[model samples]
Target: MTAQYDNLATLESWNDSFKVSPHELPGERQMRARRVSGFLRARQAELPVVPAQEAASDAASGIADAGRKTAQIEREWVSAQWGLVPRWVKSEKDAKLRAPKLLVALNETVSTTQAFRDAWLAGQRCVIPMQAFYVEDLRGGKPVPTRIARVDGQPMGVAGVWECWKDPQSGAELLSYAILTINANNHALMRRYGHPGSDRRMPVILGEGTYDAWLSARQDKAREFMRAYPANWLLANPVENKKDKKPKGLFD
Candidate 1:
């Protein structure tokens, strides 16, 4: 979802591409990869035999449903403005809210403050699916926009967290999500384009194999899987700002 604080063109493009239908909400858009050999081998070594059907059903019904059911939940309508007021927030209908943009700086001290600390501590892991995400670069003092996605050209899931808030008056529930960031991995293409620092923060990319563990309410395993993702997995490039005065190509 585009936030109001973001550039209008950026917001419009996001809404147009993502929120096409009335009931359509922005779905997660991160890249997905098959389970790598290492993780698969490790899992196989760890769990040699499948559990009984009944126990397996119970675990899947409980935890597996969390992610899927949560995914089906929708946010209340708000102007595409990024603010602290979570989509799930239902109290104070007209209250003017202010919040940081969803894209957070990982190493910054503010990230460790109350706003994010609780979710992290609570083992609240989330996945932000994105068709694409934007990045800015300066060339001759002009900000250039780049669209980043998977080299294999698939939607990606940036790790995220969801907060459920209750409306003080009616006791209605609201759910909101946020993207997590960490230092970038060293990839040759990202370096060549001067995309940003290898240390520059990026979304916590979750591998497909780990989706179950990450989404599990089991905090310990989820935390262990939250380590930074590999750099070589992402591909990025410049794109035209279609919302601008003239439809310029990436070179512009």
Candidate 2:
């Protein structure tokens, strides 16, 4: 329910903070890295390469350059949309907007309820990568934008559900994702930094140990794992907001 957050950094910084292995990179990151590589290949083909005396060295350097570019593009893309969706979704527009709002609530009652059951049954566990997240805080009479991040400045993953949907009109496929929410564990932080409204729900912050089980455990197990972690495990800080000079980070 709180809105103000301070940690905002590139996903690479987050990866380093959490000690996330390349294999642990979320599916969204892989999709983006592939897209960047694809674009670079297409561009490279369009622009002829110069003949070099050190062909092997040139090839290695070219590969490194491509990786740097891909990493940059991946960072930008992930920063813009780090949230997840169901793999079946064909496009964001084709996704079901009702029930859980993909940006905040993790669809515990709708898609996620089913997704948790399905993922547990299928034994397919997953993780969501987030550098920082925005929340709305009520201040005086207006909402403020707050960026919430880990205290150690690590990128964190909230439990998530992805859905893939097909467009009936274009027949294109799209993938979307949602975050799960539960009652706030940090009441003091919620009152001091969260939205002033009575609604104080928060995204379920999963521990590293529980992530795999939450992603791949059976339905019963996943449900048990969905419980919230201790409030002290998370650190909330005040962030700047432009809407109000003294505005808490809650709204734009």
How high is each candidate's TM-score?
0.54, 0.54
How far residue 141's Cα lies from its native spot in candidate 1, in Å, is 2.5
Stretches of model 1 off by over 4 angstroms after superposition: 1-96, 100-111, 185-199, 242-252
lDDT of 1 by residue, 195-240 (tens): 3333444556666544544554333324334455555667667666
Candidate 2 per-residue lDDT over residues 1-252, each given as its tens digit: 422122324436545544333322333433221111000000111222333444334335532222112211111112122233444444545354431334334434633454344422343334455555556666655655566666765556666454444566677654444455666635555444454545567766666544433443323334444565565656655466555376566565
User: Residue 75's C-alpha lDDT in candidate 2?
Assistant: 16
lDDT to native, each model: 0.43, 0.42
